[model samples]
Target chain A: MAVWLRSLRYAAILLAFTTSAYAESDPIGYVKTHAGAAFVDAGGETLEAFPGLALREGDVIRTGDDGRLGLTLLDNTVMSVGPNAELVVEEYLFRPGEGELGLGVRLLRGTMQFISGVIAKLRPEAVKVRTTTGTIGVRGTRFLVKVED
Target chain B: MAQRSGMHGGNLLLAALVAGLAVSACAPKSWVVLLPNEDGSTGRIIVSGPEGQAEVAEAGTAASLDTAVPETFDVSRGEIDTTFGDALQAQPSPPAVFRLYFELGGTQLTPESAALLQDVLNEVGARPGADLSIVGHTDTAGAAADNEALGLERAHFVRDRIIAAGLKLDRISTESHGEGNLLVPTADDVSEPRNRRVEIVVR
Candidate 1:
């Protein structure tokens, strides 16, 4: 009986841990500019995207055929995602002087505009954008990338 | 004469300066790592291209990646123009800007601007963590100094309202352009209603 009770308690704790991780993650970016039918997916919940709405890691942003979004990360990198685009903030870290700096994004489909910010300026290798085909590394400046489905 | 000796000393100083500059110029170029801040982003771009990987930084600098058989490359900012122009142009938009007009020499807002307050406040509240630049302006009326002071007062008044509307104080900055930058440029001390205003540019 004790063994069974302990296993049940373990399962309860695991459930609680997963629930909090998905629900209360800190935001990593925000919707600076958006139009049309853009939406943000926090874990599994999808909500319409609006300007100034907070974004977080593992969060996926999808824009309808009539939608577009401009997101500025905490590190100041500006990304403009085009219509019918899906972008994911896979990982981001922006503590400059302390050397904790990274920005990893996945452009799942459609097009993405990248303007490298402080994270890549401080350390070039720390910032990387991945598409199904290959990766985009920033030395600095702005660039555009499109992914074919 | 003392004049001749002074000229000799000056020539020696000039030579030393030239030597110093030459020595510094011959020194090997070094990479600069920019720290993150409120204004600009870093200048590094690295891409894995077919002819090995390439990296560039800054607009007018030179960087050598490999020492063996070294070749310097222009450090112009990197940009790739794939076929995303049409896609981006379909939805190009700028950040929202709010303009508020004020009465001459007073912090009181005009009737039209008073109505705009709700929308301004709502916009600020909606854009959480956005940085704002609040600029105050005045008609060419009154002494230049007083107009500047009045403009400043008006800007401060607007700033306080935005902060009271739940915007972070640190994110908003107030500036008084005074009567110098009039919307309707006029003769000095002219009371132009169009010139008196405060602008809240939210970024």
Candidate 2:
């Protein structure tokens, strides 16, 4: 009887997994370099950010006054977020071979360093970074930005 | 007259707060910088603020987007901005490539490949903090989908062999080129021995 009940519970778990809401989000990047106190706010759960931690869309990276974080995306684009900053990753898609490419991020406030990857290099106008003031368009090179109140 | 003076003082305080916020808006720090990548490819950065917009085109350049008029400075010349100095030092060296061929439609390596691992071992031993990139390719004899899987399988085989040979690298990326990028160009559905191979790029 216990075995049968355990089998039923396993089937229920399988059903819940297969029928869960389909979300097309994967780890778009990883925290390649981390220092001091940085946190990832995902679904309102603030987890301590570390190197190699996978990052996804709808995630916000909040850095303490002494924290700094570096990331490398799938397209090899690298980013460095400075101290006392809040950076949000809205969307990311990079499939250069099939030509489906995009990169979108919002910097609420703080300092950021961006190095263009394959998507921005291939399609000169596909990447967009938005701050509270305005939107930035990439033209295939490196740049830095800081948002202040 | 005294009550009126108090009202005026309150208004003055509110105005001072607003002025303080505005002053902080454009207060420029030292700078934010983007250094050159090791791979020789360049990246451009665009800054759009309330007052104006500016873009930077060169590597080793910096922008302090203070007051919306983004100013570019040559940070790499004399005194580096202490914030980005570490990132500049972390730039990768140019990649060094090693190739190993495989037999047709299988993971089995040719007899010559036995000596090829020694070369990879030597390179890994020499470089202290090098990253490895393994890319597998296949001939055009099979379906494109199947060839993709086969290519990855072959690359994984090589990756595992490298790991087993005792190179404890933390970052190793594996990819499959399938029937693309032929060393010797061939027609459709052709079997080229050289195409069935894996290329290892140590950087």
Candidate 3:
């Protein structure tokens, strides 16, 4: 009975590991540009931001005082952040065939430029950029925003 | 009494200066500005805050984010560059999309589309850290389920060619829109050549 229980525990652990790994492998975007000290916190792992870094939902992008970073989503949305910035892609859903589209981001501090993409064009109401003090509703366009400390 | 009145006037001036400084300090620190699209078209944005809401439709206009009531104001180019130069400079190249049409009811590309394959490969090679999305779409002929599978097959064909040209398989995604999303809307069982195409977006 003891050996069986141990085997069961091992199986459970293996299943959990595979599930999490699969989730992490599914990327929604890729980092295309970076300079200075940039990082991406993905699935509890802090990775140095570099070109071709895959980005997943719930990822937090941070830049040091001199850092800058740019990335493009699968839906073709482009975003870049200036120094001393913290941004998070809180939500993203771009399955167009089933009529699902949403892009939500939160800027904790600093500056960012956002260019809308297919998701914004398909469903303008579903796209939003939020700061601590305000929320922006994008209507298929490019814009710049800054949040001061 | 005149001397005392003069002192009072001086105090009033000092008080006014203090008030002005306070107002300046309390000015909005967080804001958003609209920019014209690459195609020269300006779109709109609605900024909502705890206090009120404001809409900015015109390019080069801005709205304060932390103010009691959102207000629109003109933003000069100098201010924009000074504030957003780094962010703008870091922006990646915009995504490019190409459509390749297929022969009737098959995964084989038409002669013209086959000639365009080299251009597609060249585009993929030009970008650093590039990723692609290839969605296959089909005309509204045959059953929807069969069309969906055919679309997948068509997408796979393009994906294979791209991978053979040196791009990593993980960097590409394939999907089938089937007849559900027709480029040229038509009745069921219609054979629309324009709809039988695969769209590849290189980002």
Best-fitting candidate, scored by DockQ = 3
Candidate ranking (lDDT, best to worst)? 3, 2, 1
Cα lDDT tens digits for candidate 3, A52-131 = 88999899999999999999998899999999999999999988867989999999998999999999999999999999
* CA lDDT, candidate 1, residue B182: 77
lDDT by residue (B1-203, candidate 1, tens digit) is 00012235556556556544543443223221121212354355454422354454553333222222223332211111113433344332233567788776798899999999888887766664576668899998789898889888989999998888777665566878888887887998788888889988665
Model 2, B79-121: lDDT tens digits are 2333433333332223457999988899999889857878887
Best by TM-score: 3
TM-score of chain A of each: 0.84, 0.82, 0.87
lDDT of 2: 0.70
Misplaced by over 4 Å in model 3 are A1-25, B1-27
lDDT of 3: 0.89
lDDT for every model?
Answer: 0.66, 0.70, 0.89
Model 2's C-alpha root-mean-square deviation from the true structure amounts to 12.1
DockQ of 2: 0.35
Error of 3 at B36 (Å): 0.0
